[model samples]
Target chain A: MNGAEKIRVENLTKFFINGKTAVSALENVNLTVNDGEFLCVVGPSGCGKTTMLRILAGLEKPTSGRVHINAKAAGVPSTAVVFQGDSIFPWMRVVENVEYGLKLRGVPLKERRAVAMEHLKKMGLERFAYLYPYQLSGGMKQRVNVARAFACDPEILLMDEPFGALDEQNRLLLQQELLRIWEENCKTTVFITHSIDEALLLGDKILVMTAQPGKVKALLDVKIPRPRDIILIKSSPVFIELYKEIWDLLKEEVLKARNIK
Target chain B: MNTTEERLSQNRASLGKEFWLKTFSFLSPLFLLFLWEALAALKLVDVRLFSSPSRIFKTLIPLVLSGELIYHTLISTMRIALGFLAGAIPGVALGLSMGLFPSVRALLMPLVAVTFPIPKLAIMPLILIVFGLGESSKIFTIAIGVFYLVLINTMAGVLNIDPIYIDVAKSFKASRIQFYTTVAFPGALPMIFAGLKLGMGTALLLIVAAELSAAKAGVGWMIWRAYDMFDIERMFCSLIVLAFLGFVFSYLLDFLEKIVIPWKKR
Candidate 1:
């Protein structure tokens, strides 16, 4: 189950046209995620982590390099991206936001509502299903966003610092909710984050990346057991060991990001 | 408890604030009418030329009872409604496409920019000549004015939508029809309502201008006819009715806006 590769990226390079200069965002980046595995990526600021995810989500085109998602079967969506900040449509109710992908896929209205309501329940947002995004708090809005991604039930979930903007308590609650959902329904997920602790907590394997013109630095197997106790796991020796290893791999890139080294 | 006392006091404060607001609103018009009545009673202004609030009220009653006021008001109202719908529907369609697709914008923007600024009143003579001095001509002129206001505003509304919404729709693989129905239409609704209000205002303005120039029966024509017969009080009566109509139309639009955009700030 673990070794079956669900996604493969080979020498992924991406460039942006910045007026006169062809600015490179990602340089010869290569990575893979096995089926039902959680891969967390840590990188410095402006490191094109989002660009890589956008490419994976097919929202962007790479300058060169191939990205292949091994779709297990026809009719299952290849990817559904959980964007960084508040991405829920303000005009839509919470249920509508969660049902957006299903609606786009032309699912029947009744089925869409049922599926969305189930996902909202998972996020502890069933009570607010009929409310608009504007009526919700920042943390609640992010949960709606996550619920929408989960409702899509795509082949792979591509999250780009989904909890980066949340306060600590809300972040932990959401991480715990995410773990429960993933445990119930195993999904191939590639999550990007700035926090080493988040990477240590959620990832089956951690992908440490470089600064600008992002390149893969290291890919370390987490070996942390299932059902991670998000709070208590911090005190565990193995979790602390993995945390130091990731920080060491990420520290030089952080310095390079600030141009201090 | 102190909490209950605080809540009670808060409610009382809000109620007191509302009471003062209503009182001030009531007093402003009454104060203006009193000042005008004083000026006229003291004979500072010619009574024949400057009709006082009392004189206008006297004029208003007979015209209203005779059904002349209601007839002209309804005629003008019907024209505004027709012209507004005719212009706004197509304006929304074109504006929506122009906002969503750059090609449509490129093809039509030059035409819009050039024609939008040319005064609608200036084009009245042309419209009258082309459509013939009929109800259609007046309606046509009014529609032209409303079209530009709604189209430009609706287009801006669509363009101003946060790009994150667009990205969200795209990531979900929304079809073209879905994008328009869900993303573009609902997202731009606030601006569309703004455009509709502006369009309605222009509709009112253009209809009066059209009627004054060429009509035999509407409030604008009534004002013109009163001026011809030297019926000073009657002219004032028509002006008051026109002001009321404008207020009613604006108020109706405000009420509609609240219903449509429920997610807006309270």
Candidate 2:
């Protein structure tokens, strides 16, 4: 059933023009995100992970090639994004920020409020619903970003390092919460992260991307069983072997990303 | 991430310091007034030319009771209201459109750049000739003065809004009107308020300049008449009233800003 393709990126290439020179960000990238599958992308910094997500979100047009998003659920919007930092409107209260997509969709106030409140509750932020984004901690603010994505209930959830700026503890905590929330009802999610552990913990398949002039280097499925966790997975041999294999694949790329001899 | 409760505690921690700050601000003006009175009482200064604070107040009560001051103040206030509204409405509208649409900005920017620095006061004679030195002329002058200030700030506010917010708006597929109304308007509000405050100040300034030259009835005209007759006390009294008006207008705008953008921390 998961064989059905949700998104297909064929020969995707993106170039940014800088002072009469075209700098390639993504070079002939091609990938597919299966329906209701959680695909995490791990890459070196400036690898055009964000650019790819933006293209997938339909916020940017591909310089070349094609991106096909099968919006199977008609009348339902296709994509919503969780940006890296401070994406929620500072002027809006927590609930308002969460309900923003619905508000744009012209959903009635009471109905959207109920949906936003429910998502906020899932993030343990129901108590902070009336507060402004300025009043939320970095960790809590990222949670608000997650809650908004969930509340929007788009067919595709595109996250660009939503927890990238958070401290270690908050990162693990939110990852656990995210896994729990997602496990309740699985949806097609594309999450970009810098951490291999994070990619393994959340994703069914991991796509490893190369350095600048980014291209798909490797794609591997996580064989580790579900109900896995940040700490619990550490003890599992399958998790350790998968972790070592990925680290080996990623270490060379990480060095190559820095142009290390 | 300062919550309301945390903010309250922080305020309490600095409560004594805040009190002293307010007290000092309040007392500094009174101290100056007292010193001026002392200089006048001792004949250390020319009372006839300078006029003591007491003499200014003495003249103020009669001006108020005789309805002369009230009538003039009302006229000036009315002109300010009319002109400020005229400028602010279109200024904000155009400013938002310009910031959101590059084409509108490109077309209007050259015109604004050329005309903005010519000095509205320099054009006052032309305005008077065109509008015939009536209320229309005074109101028109104030409007032009206010229009430029509000337009620039409001445009800057929209322009300064983080690009991320705009991208978020697009990802969600926000409608064109929604993009402007919900995203642009609220996002640019802080800058818009800055424009409004500056515009209000300009309105106050231009009202006086316009009324002094043209109007028969405003506080500025009253000051002009007092200056002509060498009634220094009446002039002092009118000046004090004008200062008071300025203070009131600034506080009113601050209050409105707080109400509109409550999410912003002080």
RMSD of 1: 1.9
DockQ of 1: 0.77
lDDT of 1 by residue, B1-266 (tens): 57988999999999999999999999999999999999999998888898798998998898999998999999998888889888999998899999989999999999999988998899888888899988898888878888888899899999999988888888888888989999899988999888999888888777778898778899988988998998898899888888898899999989988888887766
Fnat of each prediction? 0.64, 0.83
For candidate 1, what is the TM-score?
Answer: 0.96
| CAPRI class assigned to model 1 | medium
Clashes of each: 0, 0
Q: Give TM-scores for every candidate, taking all chains together and pairing residue i with residue i.
A: 0.96, 0.95
Off by over 4 Å in 1: B1-14
lDDT of 2 at B250: 90
Off by over 4 Å in 2: B1-23
